[model samples]
Target: MGQPLAPPPVAGDLSDRLVATDVWTDGMLAEHGIPVVDVPLVTFGGGIGSFVTADYLRICGVPTSAIRVLTPLETPWQSYEYLTTVSQIPRTERLRSDSASTPDNIWGFPSYALREGLQGDLKQLWNVLVEPIWANYYTPRAGAAFTAMEKEMHRIRYPEMVVRGQVRMVRRRAGGGYFTILTPPQGAAPTRRIAYRSQWVHVAVGYPGLKFLDDLQEYRKQTNDYGSVVNAYEPHEHVYEKLRAKPGVVLVRGGGIVASRVLQRLIDDRDRFRLDTQIVHLFRTYTATPHGTGILKRRKGADGWAYQGFNYPKSVWGGQLKQQVRKTEGAERARLYKEMGGTNTPVRRDWQEQLSRGRAQGWYRVMIGQIDRMTKTGELVEVAVASDQGPQLGSFDAVVDCTGLEADIREHRVLADLLDHSGAGRNPVGRLDVERTFEVRGTRNGNGRIYASGSATLGGYFPGVDTFLGLQIAAQEIADDLHAQGFGSKLGPGRSTSQWWKWFRNQQI
Candidate 1:
């Protein structure tokens, strides 16, 4: 999140010959003194997406020695937790995800709600049963998801497959398979660079980095005041700490889930401390009414918020929208993404009540406008707005930017290198293009494949490629593809039942 995680050093790590070649040869890597390790399947990114894929393969009888996870993270959920915590959805707070979107359980049986009920939280189970009717959709807390993942991670012996390093690039092999170059934590290996030779390469690097609005970027660049203007995705607990010490006006931008969480945190503190902290919410495009492409696809909107229980429509998972996107191409695919994609937040009763109270008390204010610019005003931040009403301006003690995931795939060095040196292409929505089976299209080399998942493959045939359940779906597809390629056993009904039992019993695979 800070400084874009400095790209892997290149000066002494790569050789001229290796750098110049598009397809890498084993001999070439050896000649350059780059240690080559052979693994049948290699997946980088080491996040939840990568973990899901590896977990599926392991359950299908793939041995740990045959798979490798190259990443800089200490754990699969490290980045996810950091982002959620900073965005104000700490361990105790519920996530904006469905109860069944369990990354740990591939079958999604005994869902989060079921588990919660087993643990004495029958209210959550009831919430899911009557979701969007008598109650809001049930969501798992951040801690529950993480704890479950930790158990699965060990059950699958995921740690054994992990190779802690920063992936630099993936190139097609001269004969077959691919060569994945990794920058080992300085001195972790004899060579600066380690080349992983694998028949299949899976990429799930998630988002390249956090996105800051142009006005916020310029404000910080000009004033060098990061403390006052912070991205909700970054560590900014100090902002709340300072506000607790004194009553102040805080400006919040964006209309997504994070904005909701941040607002709740601010109001929660104000109530707990009996402080008079005022909140100014700015919505670029206020949704005052229901909006959608058609009557059947309409989303609920009101009070300057577009309400969605989850990130995408439920149909996108396997319903009409999924079928539509899979069959569509080019402009049609792009249009579908545009029609469905937008910033929205789930409707929570507690937060809604808090917001309503604040509104009535005249402590919460909503404005509709795009920021013209921002400037320093002593310890406060002055934001100029341009909206339908007219130009306006205000000053606040702090500005919390909640907009996120706007960075392009090319912003990531490895992804850029994949496009430039490898044969990877972009989808209609400008992310890494992939086949229905999640293989990176056009990058296939004899008998080998380069598969990708997660946000990087967002615009592919799958519309929900960025969610927890989405990752599991991609893993299923990719695992099936590998099975067809004679890598792992097929997950037939018998095998699936056995694996689910093993999972339920917490038995090691």
Candidate 2:
């Protein structure tokens, strides 16, 4: 061995006192050399979820000093933009969100389409007006959304509330409330960890981590080769760059939105560079017809793809599905999620046309199968698949896995600690359980409460918990709950209108 490996800094950073105690005391923290930073509320993740909650609270008249945002990300959109970009959705590309799903503006009156129309892009306005029927649904460009969020971030003074650090764990306090352990970057603090004592804690960590297919994970582990196989969510520009350099066979996996974007990017590159790249698509389950529980709830499916305008049915936002989920409990809610959820992509005209052309040109091929094994063969990866036709094996220059996220919330350290120590429970779908008000069930410590939103709290009452609008709805519920606890002012009609004007004028709060 080169040298003996050094032990992790867990002992020094997260003291034995902090780790052993389910309920923390200030005295114990003091003894452990942990400095306590007191704030009324603490929200971790520092992503869009935290930003939206902070925005809603600020609009409801909560001061920045009363709230603290603990996160490693500098901006709310940092992680989101990175994911989108790696998945081939750059600033110029459109996001698969509704025009009204504005994370920056809660009112959503001057929607993306309206704003675009004001800026002389009348096509988006027309597209939204007669969408899905006359034309495909209109979506906002990624740049516009990020720019709006930046404006709102400055207006709300979000930076003031930000404490740059990675949150290690959260524990219930002795008297009431919670103590969150934050491990600041190296040399940023006197100690390795700082304790945040707060009455309420909000968890908005999106997904635990990326989920690699079993076969792909095994291949990577064996060969230690990340270049040949890649997840669509990660930075895999080399895949496309290699294609541009020379024509090659590529396998496009999954049938989700990211899969569509990846395919679109591949086809776009072929068209632009005049390359002879052959595209092979693999779908585990081929959808040849429409699918749903009922005619009213049916989603259009064809050509091995389920087409939807948004992530979930629009009804889940504020309609029948919302009410149905809110009223149900346990298995019924799980059943609803199963019926509504699956791999799907929106129908985009450009991609459809490009795919249709590729089909005619005999460069694009679709295979219905699950990978039995993946092996690196020379410069290419060989994949053995169990398909509808029978067993098949193929070799390609690259394999792009565009499957879903990590299902288990316990993969994240903080969430796992919550389950083990903070008395948090899992919902039917195996994520953090939360009430209608977004308060994490079973995590209440005295007068303090822990609220969770975003992907970690999916499968709760909200079916649209992962979307921008869904996050806003969660923030509203949280703000209302805080108001009930006499923390923030109520967001009444008068206040809403006044705040809307302030947002319009870009006035700092």
Candidate 3:
């Protein structure tokens, strides 16, 4: 019989062009004319989490050439700044982040409070000193945080290691290590995709993406109107802009820091322009008083919003709660996370006063409910909410959803790929599971170790895994783990002190 004819080459056949399986070898890829760049480590999601990790590694003497950062952002804080500004925290406004959680300085020395004090802001200094007692905990300005991160980024020469692109997925290589496939922007690179082969991989993709409720998404889809119902994370400056231009009523959803900021902005506009603006704040779980499972662990709440100095109990950063969480596993760890997790905002006196005045003046109202449905009524939106009192209907100019839950990690292509193809499992809390070292469990491919941090790895040993301080802590743990694997020098006190001195001196590595 005649030899069977070979099948024709298919268009966009990634089997030869991409590393889709653990069986893909460097020789196989090279034979197909695909380029492979080898590096000791590669970090995806070059946000503050990646910056902090790179910062620690650089301090430990890791060269720029040995590491690669795959990110689509031009700067580390671009995504953060976008969220903060849209949620009413302009550059000059204070962030909800604590003063001590300085992402730029790993040692947390010369905290934001101290920096403000040095600049003649004695009031902020006092506030920090008496925080959670006589006064609310003080936080740093958004601009200060961004500027500090920028300085550290340059100092570490992080930009030199950044490869701008969207990370498609990570696949295990046959010989060893892992191949991280990145889809570079069109016209930016010669190839449609680029692969980075590395022994160590760190994933810090931040929040998967801001989640808009199903109802809001549906309303937008059916009506094709993007103006009326908006998420706090997106660019909704027009919502406030139009409100400032004329009188209007806005329904603010969720009871987190973003909600507080949104309310403050509305009240500020009302007070400044003397415009008749009404705000209706909605909460899913209304906290009424000091509530908790234990006396010493009580959280303060009132007027529908729970108040806390920070996101998690400070004890989670250290002390008994930290130990309690670290030792727990599976369901127990998830339960502990639930006990401490809830939407809470710092008790800022100014916003509180604004809210109080608003309530007394009948311009602001609070309702405990979930949005049942929403329909566009001309330029306004008619909302039906299932409240504790019962079903209620309201019409508002705009609805701002401030619920900042990271959409399921699977929403991101890379994270979804990790779960489906890399044998990575989710913790009981439904976030990426990791070991005490922040090493992603079950993704060990030969000598390569996959580590994760930031919001995606929240269910690991740390409760504050998404915060700035949490990122720093995660970085330290990952750095230590890498050091143990003989990748970089261990950051003992002596080395840390010397490196800190260089930082203080404004010396570059």
Q: Candidate 3 on 1-509: residue-level lDDT in tens?
A: 12322222432123523434444567655544446788999999999999999999999999999999999999999998887888889899988788889999999988999989999999988998888799988889999999998888899999999999998888888767898887788878766667789999999999997777788889989999898888888889899888988889999999999898888888888988898998998999998888889987788888887888788888888778888899999889999998998889889899889999999999999999899999988888999999999999999999998886679999988899889788899998898999999998999988999999999998878888989999999999999999998988988889999999999887988
The local distance difference test score of each candidate is: 0.90, 0.91, 0.87
Name the candidate that leads on lDDT: 2
Better of 1 and 2 by lDDT: 2
Off by over 4 Å in 3: 1-13, 16-20
**Compared to the true structure, candidate 2 yields what TM-score?**
0.97
Of the candidates numbered 2 and 3, which has the greater lDDT value? 2
- Compute each candidate's TM-score over C-alphas: 0.97, 0.97, 0.95
* RMSD from true fold, candidate 2: 4.0
lDDT of 1 at 205: 96
Q: Which consecutive 10 residues in model 2 have the weakest lDDT in total?
A: 1-10
**Runs in model 1 with CA error above 4 Å?**
1-12
- Tens-digit lDDT string for candidate 2 (367-427): 9989999998889999999999999999999999998667578889999999999999999
Error of 2 at 505 (Å): 0.8
